[model samples]
Target: MKPVLWMKSSCTTCRNAKAKLAELGLEVEVRDYFKKPLEAGELEHLLPADPAPMLGTKSPKYKELGLKDRHLSKAEAISLMVQDNNLLKRPILVHPKGTVIGFDAEAYARLVR
Candidate 1:
């Protein structure tokens, strides 16, 4: 199966994930998720759960966009992420039906082996 990794160069998390994958000898195709927002269908599968707690900038956007006070449905979150890729969590690793966020070692281990 092919490995699809949505990556942003400047993100340390993405770089770490890439390094881990490389250490495990897993080849991945990294795409710039910032420049290209994912489709709703794609983003939907990658997101964690409802409310998307992990999704959103720790930066001022979280407060500025009022995401802290807002509650969004799955579809709403998907739409928002498509409109702004930054809304999606970093280093999303895709493999078949599974999508792992933040380059988690345990999760990526499943993909690695």
Candidate 2:
């Protein structure tokens, strides 16, 4: 199966990831998650069993939304992400081998190769 890249157009990391994929000559289906939000099932598949990986803990909105004090289950975290695309990390790359969250050049290279 072709790789799928879930990203936001305005994010620099996402842009870089997209460029890297292109540079590697790998075909990808790009999904701007903000424009076309992910479904709960999709998020479940993309995220790890732990909520921390998918949850954007560094996002300002995370604090603004008062999520810092709360302990969310995996389902809850996915629900929140579905409601606010900003709550999810950027440039999630999904391949047949595995998935990569966020921008890591080394990881991308391994996946692309």
Candidate 3:
């Protein structure tokens, strides 16, 4: 299957990730999560059991929600992400090899290799 990339178009990191993928000759299916928010079931399927890795800690929305202070459960995190897509970290790459939460050139290379 072609690798799927979940990213925000406005994020520079996400843009860089796309360029890197293209440089690697990877034709990826890009999912602009900001435009089309992810469903709870979709996030559950794409994310690991612990969804913290997928959470965007630096997101303004995250701070607005005061998630840093609270100890949230896996379910709670997922619920919050569903409620607000901004809570999710961008450029999540899903491939047959594995799922990568951020843009790592080496990881991207290994994933498609």
lDDT of 1 by residue, 1-113 (tens): 77888888889989999898888887888888777757877766666678465575564555667887788788887877777777767777787747776778878887756
Show the colliding residue pairs in model 1. none
Cα deviation at 7, candidate 3, in Å, is 0.6
Which candidate do you rate higher for lDDT, 1 or 3? Answer: 3
Against the reference, the lDDT scores of all candidates come to 0.76, 0.86, 0.87
> Best candidate, TM-score-wise?
3
lDDT of 3 by residue, 1-113 (tens): 98898999999999999999999998999999999999988987877777777789988989998877777777888898988888888889888778888889999988667
lDDT of 2: 0.86
Candidate 3 differs from the real structure by a C-alpha RMSD in angstroms, to one decimal, of 1.3
Residue range 34-104, candidate 2, lDDT tens digits: 88899999888787777776667778889898887887788988888988888998888898978888887
Worst 10 residues of 2 by lDDT: 48-57
- Reference-based TM-score of each model: 0.79, 0.90, 0.91
The C-alpha stretches of model 2 lying farther than 4 A from their native spots are 68-70
Which structure is stronger by TM-score: 1 or 3? Answer: 3
